[model samples]
Target chain A: MLKVTNDQVAGHKAGDGKLGPLIDDLGRFYKPLQSNERGSNELTFYTSFSTNTRIPGPIRRFFPNFYGTQLVEASDGSSLQPHLVLQDFNFGRVNPSIIDIKIGSRTWDPQASEEYIQKGLKKDRETSSLPLGFRLSGFQIYQNRELGFWKPERTFQSLSADEVDLLLRKFVSSNTSANLDLQPDCSFASIVYGGSTGILSQLLELKAWFEDQTIYHFYACSVLMTYEKEFVSNGKIPCAEIKLIDFAHVYEGQGVIDHNFLGGLCSLIKFISEILITPEECTTEASPKDIQKNQIYFEELIK
Target chain B: MLKVTNDQVAGHKAGDGKLGPLIDDLGRFYKPLQSNERGSNELTFYTSFSTNTRIPGPIRRFFPNFYGTQLVEASDGSSLQPHLVLQDFNFGRVNPSIIDIKIGSRTWDPQASEEYIQKGLKKDRETSSLPLGFRLSGFQIYQNRELGFWKPERTFQSLSADEVDLLLRKFVSSNTSANLDLQPDCSFASIVYGGSTGILSQLLELKAWFEDQTIYHFYACSVLMTYEKEFVSNGKIPCAEIKLIDFAHVYEGQGVIDHNFLGGLCSLIKFISEILITPEECTTEASPKDIQKNQIYFEELIK
Candidate 1:
């Protein structure tokens, strides 16, 4: 019942729509975050703000968010390079002095593009020429590389206050003493089931209430899903990973860079929002006696 | 061990010979956050950065934060009004016509301080007041007879994704399935609880990795705290109630103004840091049991 941009829930309108530099109902419920991948092949970004949150005159667009680009070759093959994924990107406002949001790699990296995808697949080179579903929101994850991908990768200004008080007392005493699921001890990446951990030894899942160890905050909604093999297809699993492949209706939050990087921000959503939002809005409401004791594991992950 | 900033954590120098602004080592882990009694004793906020994260105005005076000037009592009881808290507020670069973060409100709400706290607290007057807090992260949540906490509060951009999915499905499934031991859902407030029933509703008491429905995301660290009446420490909670707090950890992320807001910019951490990086670094590896469980939860959050 809530795909609604306004049954007045907030689609609120009053006329000439009081336009002082606009935004009375800008795009109202956001017109599918508009995108043509803005001006050619894609990879655009521009936004800056933060004189301490006094936002106005603002009007933002950008949102398709991420998909393919990073074509570097450079071994003996020179430096193939291409990493594209741009469009609509024209940001501004949110500036601790235009501070670090960088993201203009112009492309290349898969361990230096695995020798540029093995010399463009041994010269068969189509390098997929470019352009399939470009989309992209604002992907700016850097790495000249040494080894990364387990999780817990700090450096958001190397953070400190004792690593934000050891990431909020190991995220509220990691469920009564060490049950941490995985992702943090970051030099970055390692997983054979929660590997090489150490930031707060991973267990946050996705917290959003007054956010972080709370006092007054309650605008909630969260996401962080990361799993890949390109996410699935030939044997299935894609369509936004079979519409949120029901990982037991996810919930784990306390913080350590939000339990190891919002699971890559839930693997770049767009499994067509898998029916926008449901598994009972990402589940979590047990009991009919634990929903009749987990009712066949919640009908086998909503089948 | 990282309270470092006089420079050197990776090589060790901060012998604290104090070249200034090591900020008493994150001020022995932050104590005074205060702001209750009628609020705004002019609260301060600091978070400087550089070493490419840019802040360089001679190391921005080593990050001095929060500048406030306080004294209030003017509901026309003749004067004592002054209040400021601006501090080193820079927003010069990262241009797009230029604005670099702004906020100069004489009134977004608080209509003339709700006609002076409702006709000046029935004429006892010394009232340069502000019971308005609940600015929904600067957007909506109001009620006035001269502000006396009612509870319709809206902000987080005046909620409406179906009142944030009917208040996260009535606080994560009907008052979190009528709380038994899981306690949490009264709207929550008393500083840093992690919203949506704070501390991320302890993942609705887990219920064994959220039985099947699957959608995982948890890793947060958003502390803003403001609530004091500890039975009457004589503190009146005001710094303008940061506009009437209620965060549920601000999450709506897909973009609709901070793109569904929730601590912005996360492209699945740029697709796993653009997938297992390595030119010479960002390779990441470790799983000795998640780096000995993040050094025993960073040694139990700085003990």
Candidate 2:
């Protein structure tokens, strides 16, 4: 039986009578094709991207391995519908910690309708995407073998600049609980994001491709970062994977650099790199006032 | 299309016009049921073991998670056949190294016919099983991102006692290639087999259960050991898994200890533990003559 993937930290989900992605026992993810132009566009993107010889072999590893498509029994009990068959990144993981960061300050494509552009612009401005070039759409952290998820109701659209950093800090903190507290322990930061094979290296690899290639412009796309919390907690070297997900709003770049995506990626990389350099003891001992002072200092530094 | 599982280290395979195990894209293992009593016996064992309240929950994790049965198109182009749908332990693994070790010095049960017992005894005596309590049925090791498998022709039936130890050590050595060389690097042994969450601890947990439970005697059963060579070589803690596989020859223990399986398990554990304790430098510097002398020392210690 197909099950709704609990580890999906963001994007559309299987609920409210809408067909969402379903994961099967064989580590295959079946994402139901939406009966709209968006679905067709995504299918087209995956198909073209798969066979595109211009895309280097090294860059291909950043995207999910698409196994074409299949017609499966729909989750909503509808007729057999075509679904994108992709690799389930969270498969065979134990207590995996995941974060979905929606990239780009502008989420709408150039060809988007005026109404769609306005809607996307409003969300981008309301979240950290405007100020920081990226926003935390959702995240789930496993602490002490228990999962603590970011509340859906929060939407994370109104987080202040400091709050955004706090969230990113909490994501790498081993002592942080589910309440999204700003904890002092950044012990897992270097292991998860700093090493040669860590998320930083993978994102930089993707950035290098985006810096030169003008193949596709990805709008409303997210960088999904995942690592096993069980391994991290046990003091094992964390093997982090970063994948670019969501392609409903992807469009041809027309030989232009995707500055929007590049900007957001650079911003996210800066935040992670800063976290790797920050002193754990300083964060551990900081009081609320000290944190406020530090925030003011950070804001001044950015200015 | 269903594919023959390439990662399966041993047992009846799909070749030779016979139905073998098939792995689906969803990471489910479909082991075809035999048309004889052996198939029915295995089915009964899984069905009963799944719901057997007498078995503790901890012990159940050692066996594959049974997802009932499925009727799929046969690999031999025959009609629909029932296959036991179990969790594919090797799913979602990158360059997984696997070994299938058939447990027990005596592989034939009391219920076997006289002719069958004699045949089993002859084979066991000829192999390492009679001398070392267990024998390597088959194995595949991943090195340098390439898979090197043990030759099927070799069968691994005639390995001497010291040769068995060398094989165990090679299994954990990162430098050992597919040619089954006696490498000195046991770098992955402590992480894969010695730690609290490693194979040794997991085996001890299973041994604890076998010491008390009077469930069934597993004749010709195998303990399948697997870990990701990619993770191990990358200096990540190897999350090794050990599963009790192949229940075709299982029989009711009738309120007695499963000493046959237990003894083999203990012997296997001892070999692994020895590998963990042996200094890496000692193995690295040892000559062929030194290894021969060490083999004699090990033989004397075992006696």
Task: Give me the runs in candidate 1 sitting further than 4 Å from their true place.
Answer: A1-267, A270-303, B1-224, B232-260, B264-303
DockQ of 2: 0.01
lDDT of 2 by residue, B5-59 (tens): 8887787778656778988888889999887989999999999988898888877
List runs of model 2 lying over 4 Å from the truth: A1-303, B15-17, B146-153, B178-180, B279-303
Which run of 10 residues does model 2 chain B get worst, by summed lDDT? B145-154
Model 1, span A1-303: residue lDDT tens? 102211110112222422111111222111111124321212222111112132222111112233334343322233343433222111211110001111110122112235543452222112111110011211111111332111222222222112222222222121211223122232111221122221111222222211222111111111211222121212433111000110111122212122112222222222112212221121212224433433433233224
Docking verdict class for candidate 2: incorrect
User: What lDDT does each candidate get?
Assistant: 0.21, 0.74
The per-model DockQ list reads 0.01, 0.01
lDDT per residue for candidate 1 within B56-159, as digits (tens), equals 34323323244444443322333344433222111211100100001100111111245542352222112101111111121111112243222222213222
Candidate 1, residue A111: Cα displacement in angstroms equals 23
